[model samples]
Target: MTYLNGVQVSSAAVSTDPLSWLDERASERTDAGLRRHLRVREPESPAIDLASNDYLGLVRHPEVIEGAIAAVRRWGAGATGSRLVTGTTADHALLETELAEFVGAQSGLVFASGYAANLGAVTALAGRGALVVSDAGSHASLVDACRLSRARVEIAAHRDVAAVERLLAERTEERALVLTDSVFSADGDLAPLTELHRACRAHGAVLVVDEAHGLGVRGDGGRGLVHEQGLAGEPDIVITATLSKAFAAQGGVVLADARIRAHLIDAARTFIFDTGLAPAAVGAARAALGLLRRDPTMATRVLDRAADIARIAGVAEPDSAVVSVVLGEAQLAFDAAQTCRARGLDVGCFRPPSVPTGTSRLRLTARANLTTAELDVIAEVLSEVLADARGTERISA
Candidate 1:
């Protein structure tokens, strides 16, 4: 027997046809209601969008558009090369400075995407001899980072500070890193930042918080939950955030102590090897940051919208802009999403691997600019679909 992509197969079976096993896997997925396909969205969509991560609705703001255009005109389309090479432009430096200052960090380093930033930070900070205590509910990028770090990993119970502290206290390794998401992506719940940080401090471990979902929707004026908890700029705490979400740009950043920043510059392969973030993305993010500074009310508006969505969907109040409605079966979630689309609403359906085995759900994002009419439309569509789902369940029972 041999392992092929984690599935064990007899050598004889593999020798017959190397690609034949894919057909069986495909059939299994089809039967499980786990098959997925991509659809192209219209450029001028008529649907009320509740699927995107543009929490602040700055993607098309006039200043954001002008920032992209100006960057293209001044710095060309791309960063030209990796940051270590010729990709580090003046815009990149300026953006880094502004991001560090805005997030209350001593320094910052930009990466191609949030995934890369997480991977770079985790791997660079926790290596083969270190112990990595990770939250079980962390984003996939962080999970992958732990794997790549080749460290002794301990997955603490989700949001359980006691479990994390236990792991940290029992670990034999002197160097340890605790990893978690500030705002969980699927259920939109928040981590206990204060308790987690306290535990890390007690154990003398560094805490790495991914603020991808928290940066644009939490804290005072969206400085982020870390800043809100007075953990920003702490020597033992590091933050990794995505520019693609609230910033409405396309990159990632690691904000940390100045010493950590220098370490990542020298050790993080993702930053050293990947091409620098596009010039347009850097410019757009900078512009969005400026807008947020000018209009702090946008952050509050997004949370209010999320609360409205949760009330309409009859789910728990959201901790962030993401409101998830659990629908049980994958097929039910897919059908409900399609029904909403038919009613001129665009929402996300997350099944199987994206969520836990039994919690297929409708993932809705609250945008700052979503109007009352759009909220009403969403509520109406959701109510009808949920009623139908219940009816089907009763009949099946």
Candidate 2:
């Protein structure tokens, strides 16, 4: 065995034994009830979907399905290369234009996934010489982006505008970025975008808002919270969103000024190196966007369902379509999720490190298409789960 950074390493059996620490971690996770296994979902499964991000329930819309099929027939199965090469199709350009126009942005750039979009935006915009002030409740993607940014990063208390303002005002770097989520995933709460933008303007800092959970569930006609706040056209504010969440597709986009878009095309490493967003996803997203534009009422229906869910779950109605039920302890949340599944409901189970310790939760997302019968079933199952969990529940919902 050889020593490397105080760790033992050997050439023979290195492929297997070198990763033995992973086994120990797995054992620890199992002991703590943190071990997770993927559940196979058949296309025709009968389970009620309260866990997916399909806020409008458009994933199975005929038009969206046809859009994907048409795209595949026309563009083949994939993009074939990065956008800088042969991957930028006319479909890509059109979708980008429509998305930018929908959110009132000067331009838009698509990425393979929302995670990549966040990574590209943060890394390209903020680097070693800059500062990044992030909300404590930001998604993992944004947190990872801040790390990849190589900037001096600070975490303000969740929804603490004053702390964020102070961080921006006190930063020594010539450039700074204020990062936040329009709709926080875990708690399903809205951020103070207007106030954050004001502070950013006062301190000459850029504001980046991830609207992954906001785009199809907030604002009139589902234009997103940024648009609702009348900040869509602001040059200093950047918006990143996932097509998958609301659009029922499989990609991400950065909506910004034409200049910023140009810079990202040139400097965003993720965009430059990663294979372009698939054509089928572009087609599906475009179809979903068209549906949203034509039937703006879908957004309202989603929120209404969300409110119903909150009322049934005995929690406050959320700002978006997410209804979160905190069940505390990892095992408790796991059991509740399993119970829900057994009752024909599929709900999200968020535990530590996804959430803070002692704050494991069952995250339920509302869908525009969820029937009244489904809601009643949810009430039947969830009420029992929560009441039972109360015996051991530590954190409050």
Candidate 3:
């Protein structure tokens, strides 16, 4: 007999069940009430949607649909090969230009997804003999990028500018990259970009801000937090964002100086090896961006709606579209989310790995197009749900 992942199995049994170790992990997850499930949603859900990152609510907009259809008609269904080969389309170049201009960057490079963009930017820019300082609350993609960058990685305290500065000042490497999210994904908190950028400048480090939750939900005309803070065209700042969120499409992009963009094109493995973003996603994102450009008020509308949701839930308004009601314990948060769903409202339930062990939460994301009636319903449902789930300890900042 042998112990496989602490599960006792006979030699003969191991031959029959080579993957039996996974069962023990699955059982552990179930016992901890941390097992996740995939609920298949229809094209349109009947429930009021407070669960998605569609800040501009343009996913189903007619122009966006038309843009996608037009791209498919013009460029075919797939990118076919890596950009270095045959995947780069006219639409890709146009979208990259439009995005760079919109975000006030000297240049831009699109990627297969936000994750790939982070991987590409970090890996291509910072490698051996470099130091990387990451915010504690950065997205998982950035964390993975740091690990894969082959640099000495240090996790500064969450949004702690002083800590970031200390790490940069103490680093022995010739080059350093500071990575953070302009808007935190789970808690919807804003990073101290200006302070961090100042520190980076003082220490001669590059600052990389992932605007995954910032673009289309922050800044004047949805230009993102970096643009709002006047860091858009800074030579040492690199901005990464996802089109899948507010752009109502797919893909990711890195916005930076022309030189940085050139280096990524040549050295970023994710870009050199991955297929270019599909034409439909490029077109749809472009159309969505065009809509946001035409009506910058959509940014304000989404933030206002988020404030409304926060007020109704008896929680402080978040900096971004994400409004979290931290209900202690994983099962409790899960139950609260299910209760909201039963009341015809769909909200995000974050637990365990997404947040701290004791800080499970019901996450509600606001959209620009939420109607007054929808807000009222959210208020009613959350009121009832919280009334029952409020016995737990409140969330800490």
Candidate 4:
């Protein structure tokens, strides 16, 4: 047996070399101008700052900063342990209670990230033989959750209620879940939650909504999309949100029926094994929520700013705080982003994998704190950049 093992090991040993396929892929990305690079900038830099997801512009708000500082001073910087162990701080509990009340849910659970919360919700709520009917354009986190759940996943066309109904009808199983995003991250389109809820009821399936982009930007006082659609208190509904965006905090949450929330407290691996959110983030989120409740005008201002940006671009009409300016090719999109950056305007450059349907675009997000003068400058620069790119078919920068 040892001699045979030795011969097999010798045969399996191969020289260390780069895979040809990987090299080809790298070359393909370079040639198509779709290669991604990161830029480091100081927080105080004088950039136009259209790239970040600070919808309400609360990241720099004094209240939010003070809340974070107070929490850290009181509870320390780290969570120190998992929730099931020693990580469940007083701040976490307070944040959960407030978040659930704000979103009209019976209860809520906090997680380290929006992605982790999505995974915990999707994977724990469904299992093998369970049916998961998902939107084709749902976020990658939810997609990966479905894959990890090992359930029979049937992807319906994006926002197609009839297709979801058809899939639910054809299935022989009784256990099923329908998942979608409240507002799509790429194009800022909203899902038809009313139609989806009605279909799910008819099919006896649970509905899960990811409100990552909708929270702090939709509904009454930015309670989120589910609240805006009047589905917040549904008995069979579940919603997930990221605090990092509009909340200007640093955590994620899973909101659901009381029973499901209890189940997650016991069974969700992401919650059980991962350390709880830091006290600073929890406190910051609480403070942000309070600020939103007090100042509803913040939501309106940012949404209006996003609309103005779309009108100036004349390419993509934004439905929410995100506006995507379409560029025909990947290289042009990257170059346009660089040009915008050179002009001290930072924006997101999205290509094949990040965008839906292989569309390349410049993604701009609006903030409530940006002055009208700043926006006008951004508009002028962007219009000039687009005109130059359209005329020359490339950004000279």
What stretches of model 4 exceed 4 Å from their correct place? 1-15, 18-22, 356-358, 392-397
Q: Write the per-residue lDDT of candidate 2 for residues 1-397, one digit (tens) a residue.
A: 8766678878563554777889999999998989989778898989899999999999999999999999999998999989998749999999989999999899999999999999999999999989999999999999999989999999999999999988888889999999999999999999999999999999999999999999998998899999999998899999999999899999999999899999999999999999999989999999999999999999999999999999988899888999999978999999989988998999999999999999999999999999988888888888777888877343232
Full candidate order by TM-score, most accurate first: 3, 1, 2, 4
Model 4 agreement with the true structure over 1-397: per-residue lDDT tens digits? 2234356445344435648668888888898776777667886988888899999999989999999999999999989989889858877888889999999999999999999999999989898878999998899999999999878999999999999999999988768999999999988899999999999998899999999999988888888889998898898899998999999998899998989988988888999999888889988988999999899888888888898888777755676899988786888888899999999899988888887534788999988788988878887788788888678443222
Worst 10 residues of 2 by lDDT: 388-397
Q: What residue runs in model 1 are displaced by over 4 Å at the alpha carbon?
A: 1-16, 392-397
lDDT of each: 0.92, 0.93, 0.94, 0.88
Q: Residue 242 lDDT in model 4? A: 93
Residue pairs clashing, model 4: none
Error of 1 at 18 (Å): 1.6
> Can you write out model 1's per-residue Cα lDDT over 55-161, one digit (the tens) per residue?
99999999998998899999999887889987478999998899999989999999999999999999999998899999999999999999999899999999999
Q: In model 3, which residue pairs have backbone atoms overlapping below 3 Å?
A: none
The per-residue C-alpha lDDT of model 3 at residue 323 equals: 96
Off by over 4 Å in 2: 1-16, 392-397
What are the models' TM-scores? Answer: 0.95, 0.94, 0.95, 0.93
Model 4: which ten-residue window has the lowest total lDDT? 1-10
User: In model 1, where is the ten-residue run with the lowest total lDDT?
Assistant: 388-397
